[model samples]
Target: MMNDIAKMQELWQEMSSWMTTYMKSFYSPEAAKTAKSHLEIKSAKTIFFDDAQIVDGIILKEKHTWKVVKNCENLAKHLNLNEHDSLLAKMIGLFHDVGRFYQFTVYRTFNDALSENHAKLGLKVIKDLPFMAKLDEEDLATLKFAIGNHNAKEIAPTENQRHLAFAKLIRDADKIDIYRVLKPFLGPTDGTGCSPDFVDLFVAGKQCDYTKMRTQDDRKLVRLMWVYDVYFAWSLKQIVEQNYIEDIINNLVQDEKMMQGITRLRNYIQEKLQTKDIWQG
Candidate 1:
């Protein structure tokens, strides 16, 4: 894992240098400077701090960010959003996890209860740093709202529908890719210090009732609940096509109860996908 992370960092540096040169060719010198400064801060503050904890957590997170960005692009086009909206969606995905770097660096765990609310921490980074200051007022608010609320259980009531919509996009995109991250890591392994009990709970026969989730293994239930948070049918379609749920289930110990629970969740998603009134309304 350390070797993989080192390679990823090296690739990131190469990509950053290439991008800096590319930006200078067409971007105004001032814009180029700001962009380069942003990259420098990302490297110095988040990516290259020489901490094992930060580096380890960020590899999955950084890949997740890129996946979300691509997912948002496809979602925007399918939803027929304007070019500006599409770009905004991509940007929100890119910047959503800025807080996680700080959280992991300080607390060494992704658990918000143990550390801090990563979303709020991310909001502070965006507002306090010049990294996101280049955005105009409208773009800035949308980015802030989307990133700030991406992890919330429900979208906050908003007078601005755009904020809710963009937030929904990021939430769906983020959750969709998370299945990829969880598949390999959540299971039990020998001598790796992974929790076998957690893997059992994950592969257990019933949909984990969140209220009943007291053990660390039960926490995997939250990933299952993400299906409820999904907004767009397009995102749901992608989830289905990727067979994310099936892949997850395949790794688990299945029984009648587990099958039933999985069926209920899958059916709910299918119902949501077919319910045009709910989406249009």
Candidate 2:
């Protein structure tokens, strides 16, 4: 039998491989020249930050996911049985940001300021493809259910362990990557020294300049903090086992308030490690 694991890998590869090709072929050379000639704006940023941003975000999301996959594989081996569930965990990590490609290609914006949820966009990408057809309904359900809900209020109802597992993989992998990347500020970042009131309002936790309570960019930062907010022993274990807390604390820059926030989360992590982290995770 091919088994679920092989099938899951095939599905993930199918999406990733197509995504790579699409990013290249999306705007053909003639289209690029003609489009540029048509709408070239002198004031517009060269290489729209949005474009690089999503690309980098997806790239980072994938990189972080690979770390989770490695850890999950090691975890599965330690738990000592083999099947596709571990691979499923890895696949979840990979697709959690799979929508960014389309969101960028279609909207030229990842900010949601451009108006579309990446999660929703991701589902569109999954549904349009030959690869999505390959998975059985169970795997397909896990794909959307996990990816869509990765940023959702609940990863899944507690009863759906298989669905829940995929979500957890995305959460851990995404946070681990973010913390490792953003944690290292030598001093207070000072809100990049300067421009918009948006940063000021955000760090202060006041109403933002933007209409949405939180923008896509803001949500990314908020989600980073929410990593500390995760519940579940396996998730907690993954946090410590992955060293996300250390990554954040070691590079912390303090605003008195931000410092307090970091301090609190650090204590919470310590408690989870000492009192609650004994499981196989």
C-alpha TM-scores of all predictions:
0.70, 0.62
Q: Write the per-residue lDDT of candidate 2 for residues 179-275, one digit (tens) a residue.
A: 5555443223334332235334434433332334333334333433464445444556665676655543443444565555556666666676565
Q: What residue pairs clash in candidate 2, if any at all?
A: none
| Best of the candidates, lDDT | 1
Candidate 1 structure, TM-score to reference? 0.70
Name the runs in model 2 displaced over 4 angstroms. 1-16, 23-81, 156-158, 181-187, 191-224, 231-262, 275-281
Model 1, span 116-197: residue lDDT tens: 9899998876576543554567878988899999987677888887887889888888877877777675553222321344
The CA-based lDDT of model 2 is what? 0.54
Off by over 4 Å in 1: 1-53, 131-133, 188-213, 250-259, 275-281
The models' CA-based lDDT, in order, is 0.63, 0.54
